[model samples]
Target: MSQFVCVRLIQGNGLDLTLFQFDYDLTFAAFFLNADRTLYGRYGTRSSLKEAEADMSLAGFRDALAAALKLHAGYPGNREALAGKQAHEPRFKVPEEYPALREFKLKLDYEKKEFNGCIHCHQVRDAERRLLRERNEPLSDRDMFPWPIPDLVGLALDPEKRATVKSIADGSPAARAGFRTGDDLVSLSGQALVSTADVQWVLHNANDGAKLPVRVKRDDREATLMLELPTGWRRAADVSWRPTSWDLRRMATGGLVLENLTDDERHEAGVADDKLALRVKYVGQFGAHAAGRDAGFQKGDIVIEYDGVSKRLTESGLFAHATQVRKLRDRIPITVLRKGERVKLTLPMQ
Candidate 1:
């Protein structure tokens, strides 16, 4: 039972606010009270109520919340009438004795976490895990984050190429293993890696937190890089995230698309040889959407410029921006170059 709260505010008439604007200030505070009315967890923004001013309007913001609550708790037929309309509302009722259930109910009572928020699932899972831990329970190997990180296949060839460097996502165990770009992988233990599948196969059989022998080919020689594997590799497959519409929007739009500019098109557009004759990959899926469709962008479009700035797709931060920023569908605004022309559009995550 996790709780979720969404606070939407309509700024004063003159306030400059857009859907694209990222709000980091508005904090929802949940003050749980015990049977004796004693204060409990003050879950909300990262600060106290007094410290959260200027950036937030607690009262005006809370008014809508109070109204909604009053409707649900006091107004006649409000709950029944709105039940089908509120898709995100919690569906289950909780009993009083369960502490986790109680905490979850308390949070929801204040609208801290959403009924379907990540915190909600985590809270429920946390509660169950806590009960298990209290009873000295143990979880199986498949109940953890997947690990036994592997080097990208073909890493041995042109290992110095930054373009080919393996992606080491943040918080991954490989990050803890000191596995960095340009550190050519030679082998596991004493065996040489012939393909990416080889590394994957080795990891498939490996267990959690197990230290394995690693040999990295660096500067034309082989060197062993000792590292430990993280636990719960099997559990990785079972994990799933309930992406917000914003998350879906970001995923749909962010990714690189490059197409080759034909010789006739290049001449017609007066594009230079330096700008043409090669496929261009840019941030977000440019040619893959309705806005970008049939605009001469395809699997191979040569990009000349982006937003009047001459730069590579990787250099422009479009790819990273698309993947990193989970923006609401309303705020997406960006333009990219395709075949010497600039095309701007909002991306909808598929």
Candidate 2:
């Protein structure tokens, strides 16, 4: 009665590194592939690290599995259609090959406590960024913004339906491309859409200001549209909600979790709503991340300005400034409101 066979991989050992490709931050993921290593589709997505199922669902997984099976039935004949969905040659062929991870004693056995000895998924991304940082290379937008979300292009997809348009943001690239709510996305930039992650894959490969061809099934009809991406569009995605953002926090703010003050809070603090007022929500207490704490930063401090400038307000914006404009170990002046008084302190960039 069942047409599908499922195999669960509880460990990363003996996994073919070349065939399986996905976001390192993913908690649960599935890669449908042929025995020959041809990738069919992927099913897993997450927007918020705090919420494991934020952008995934059983309905979506079912649709993706069904789609993969359909593609399999077509077999080699449909290979051309799925060409763009294939994984690219990775920078590192295997986890053990990564220079940053070579020193760690990694074990792949899931049954043992040493299962923790295995290289975690996020480590790959962390290692990549660390490699760039160690090389003293400027972090490019792609390095800073890996795995661009569909929201960057103004498309909000339904988590319950594979590749279905849940909503279109006003004046977004999707809206301009004539995308409508309830439309089933068929392909993006010549790649067949199997899951939300597939869409993100396409977007991740897309260049800024590139015009992408989008095909969607609207009702019983199919139509093609062009989604024109503008420059700096990837910045629209907020990085604060990601679990990997902790690494970013360490790099940019020296382990300070910052949040913009609410209007009421700002008013009570006598700060204008339009001004930069980032509250120190949490300060790292130990290790390399504790540079802010070491610099005498305390909890509940409201940072009003950095380096004689107060234009950047959001944490992400401030981080961009710190990592991009300022050099590492740069001692910068910071103004913070502490216990009903303005206090100035020199903070060193880590």
Candidate 3:
């Protein structure tokens, strides 16, 4: 803890807008920087909500800190190489700047009562989505899925070792790139890789189907390889396990958790095997999330069609349709089968 000048920011009190810039979805994160806040690199990443440290580790953190110090010693000599490591200009400078967050009492001063009216990290992501909804703009897939993990490209990196290749999926892009187990990633694209988050940043900025250059060290020898990404690679990532998925649920399904109907259930319902039939696993009972309940939707209902269309089968697909194709507050006609009776219902898109 005493290796460097460490400032613990517990409750977002007097948070520096410039220094604290990052994706709000992060549970725990750190910025290794010089006194002037020239970012050496970032040190936290997450792929699942249940496991906050799924993509980070203490060992990796130490390695990143040491790398930051190395960069610090080099300073202006390596300044050009580090320029792309910094964050881009944000849509809103501060958390309170968003209209949805403006009403909440927030502490602008950190020293005194740092916990007072502190805005939680998750709220920032929620607020950003709210702003887009208010502006009548559809949330792009990139906005919905941010900071995609390297696993999306078929590499399961060692969380304990900084940028070490642990396992590669068969026939995955990484395998196609000739990446073998035990190879330590030196850099990704053009950015120096101190931790997994740094790799994620490079992947996040890459265009779909872009061929990225990767440098790795194997048995004391360094080699450069080409990683060719195919179309729709980002869809391999799952967002249902994220904390922000609850908000997506409300916006897309009106507070209903849905699951794909089994083959037997589809047979009994007389629906085609290829048809879209999602069974209601659970329905929210109270508050804003209970819009499904308020709209007369009940547990055990099987949704066969949404907005007179029977194309989307999976919950994620339905969510994409609702949020991307439909506008906020739009009334969608949903057809469901309840207790051997076909029922027609209208659900208001939140």
Candidate 4:
């Protein structure tokens, strides 16, 4: 810590998007950069909603810091290798630039002793999606699912080490690429790897069906492997656990946060395993988020059919279908199971 100057930014009220671009969904994110603004790498990763902190540790932080210092020592000689780490030009430069966040000022009003309100990191992602909704632009798989965790490709990383493979799933891209459990990821594509977040950065920028070359250390020897992704790989990701999923609810399910019914519950509800069995877990209140409630949806309602479609679908899949198929202001008919009886309902597409 003594070797570096630390600046902790608590708010994204006036965040300079052109300079500080990373995964906005993260609760905590850090950047390692040179004085001239050359990016070394990023630190921070979350893959679970129940235990988001389980994937990070002080040891991993120390490993990433040491790696950054090593990169810093190499300096200009490694600058070309760091070029891919920089962010691309964004549609909205800053948080406030998004249409949904236009009501906000550049900074927060801090007249109060404890300081006033400010934009939370998750709000930035929410605002981006809301702006697209306002523009009537359907969200692509890339937009809905950003910064895919390594596990989606069948790679589970050891948090205590810098990009060390913990496990590989059978028949996955990582396994097909010859990634072993004990292998240490040295680099992805051409960028040097420092943390799991760095691997995510490379995957984030990758196009469908792209071939990513990886350098790895296995059994005290260096090896090169190629990871080939099929088209629509991002579609395999599940985004229902994301914090921005609330905004997705506002746009897709009329502010209803739905959950898949358990097998027992499905049997009791007379829903077959292959039938729609989403239960309305939470209904949003106020503004656009209140659409479901306004449309006569109850929290305990079991959604057996949505938008005239009735098949087994996760909440995440339903979100994708709703946003892409339905237009703004269009109401879709739905059927729910209430007290062992069927009830008809309408869900507005906001």
Candidate 5:
């Protein structure tokens, strides 16, 4: 640890959005860069709050540091190859500069144990989405779900190791691309890998129907594969796990918390596996959150269909569908099962 200088940034008050781009919801993240601002790679990855540590490990971090030192030694000669790893042109220079967050201060008062004016990492995301929503612009896939984990396309990496494939989901894009267990991911889309977070950075910028070049080391031989992302692949990402979903709930479902029915619950409810059978777990009762309650939605109602779509969708998927397909204040036709009788309702988009 004494070999390199470490700087810890605990607040997002004056964060340079132009340079430090990453998953804002992550509890921990790191970047490796030369003195000249040439970034080597990034570290830190997480899916849900409970599993924040599942995708990262100290041993993996050590390996990444070693890899960064190796890259530093090769510096100018390898600068071009590191080009793809740098952040793209930013929309905003800093968190406070965002249209929705202009009221926040650029710095905090250190003497105060708690700075009420301080901006958090997650607020950066919330502010961006708010700006877009205020402009009545449709949110993109990346906005709805940012920094998708590797498992979305199906590659489970070991936390204690750097980019080592631990398992592959059956019939997934990774498997289709010929990714095998125990293979070490070397690079993706021309950028060298340092940790699982780097892999996500590549995926975050990728668009629909994109084919990404990937290289892996298997049995001491390197092999290349094309990761084919089909249309609507980003819809698989579940945003309910993110803290930002709280705002989404107000904007879409009117603060109604929906939960998917279990296997046994579905069977008893006569709902098929592929059908929509989400139960209304809770309905907010005040201000903007009271829209769900005012719309005639009950806590125990089982949602069978929404907006003429009947296929299964998680709460996050429902938010994505509403955001992409329906505009704000659009009344959606919905059917729910209440007390063994089918009831029709209208959910207003906030």
Candidate 6:
């Protein structure tokens, strides 16, 4: 479950303001700061008084909280009352996946210190590749076409010596920057890749559209390639082993195009297959409610066929129909599987 808390702020110079409310279970502190860096308002999520006091003393936590409060004030709403603004966004970056918490915890593991930097650096690199692939961008081809990137962790490879490269997708920023397949990624933005964490550390903090310096090893020669960051893009090829429904939701563009399911998705969709495939899960009750209660569907129903074609929901003509032919709130007939039994439901296009 998610908790949303609103801060009540009083306008004053950094310090002359009142301390607002705090939530304990979620581990957050919300408040405003002045241009000089002194905090004005206050809110926190520490469960204990000591914890709250200590968190307030940390430079990192204080900086983060101060920034959150300031950003919260500028949103398309009033700030004096600060009744509805929330504090969840900056409290965590990449929270849903590839979270910093795990990377942070791994950095402090005393038993793993010897491997910490190297191990996490590669993890970062892998995540970067996954990001590129998900955006349908090709790997940087430093050597030639059809670059082969082996699974680093699975292959028990040495992080510092191991190299993985992909052919940069055509018409992408990487491609525009002249990257090609077989190009070995030696470093990012001038920082050498020594561990998984290093890659993650850099990418996590990079500006969305900035040009990043990449040193590549091509044809046994090292060269530097300036690659532009492609924001909010993923590789197109199928590589997900257990793609979440969340991943599918992210893939939708102008129209729904279903992705091949990951292993877990196949199981959830009641299909047993080794190859990646995509399937439809229920468009939740909340979604139905948004559909004006005319959405001819209910929870727990799996879309089986759309427009007489037996295909995945994102791939079905029915989905396209929703995008093009159907008007908002228009009712349409759809066939689904409910508890292993076929059922026809008419849901309003929403």
Give the alpha carbon lDDT tens digit for every residue of 26-107 in model 3: 7898888878878878888887777877778888888888877788889878777677777777777677787877865555
Cα deviation at 208, candidate 3, in Å, is 1.4
Candidate 3: residue 7 Cα off by (Å): 1.4
Best by TM-score: 5
Per residue, candidate 6 scores C-alpha lDDT tens digits across 1-350 of 01224344222112111222222122333444345333333333121333434322344343434434544455334333233222222321321234322443322334756434322222332343335444444434210011111221111112222233434455666666666666656666654442222333344345446677777778999888776655422222122221121222222211122344556756876754532233343343333233412344444445565434454433322323343344443555656566667777565433
TM-scores, each model vs. reference: 0.26, 0.91, 0.88, 0.94, 0.95, 0.30
lDDT of each: 0.36, 0.80, 0.80, 0.87, 0.88, 0.38
Please rank every candidate by lDDT, starting with the best: 5, 4, 3, 2, 6, 1
Better of 1 and 4 by lDDT: 4
lDDT of 2 by residue, 75-101 (tens): 898888789888888777666666777
TM-score, candidate 5, is: 0.95
Pairs of residues at least 3 apart in sequence or in different chains that clash in candidate 3:
none
lDDT of 1 by residue, 191-277 (tens): 333333234334545676677676776677766666566553333331112112112222333343444456676676666655523
> Which residue runs of candidate 4 sit more than 4 Å off their true CA positions?
109-114
For model 4, residues 55-117, the per-residue Cα lDDT tens digits are 889999999999999999999999888989987888778888887778777886566453655
Cα lDDT, model 2, residue 288:
73
Sequence-dependent TM-score of model 2: 0.91
Give the poorly placed runs of model 6, Cα more than 4 Å off.
1-161, 166-172, 195-197, 234-350
Worst 10 residues of 2 by lDDT: 106-115
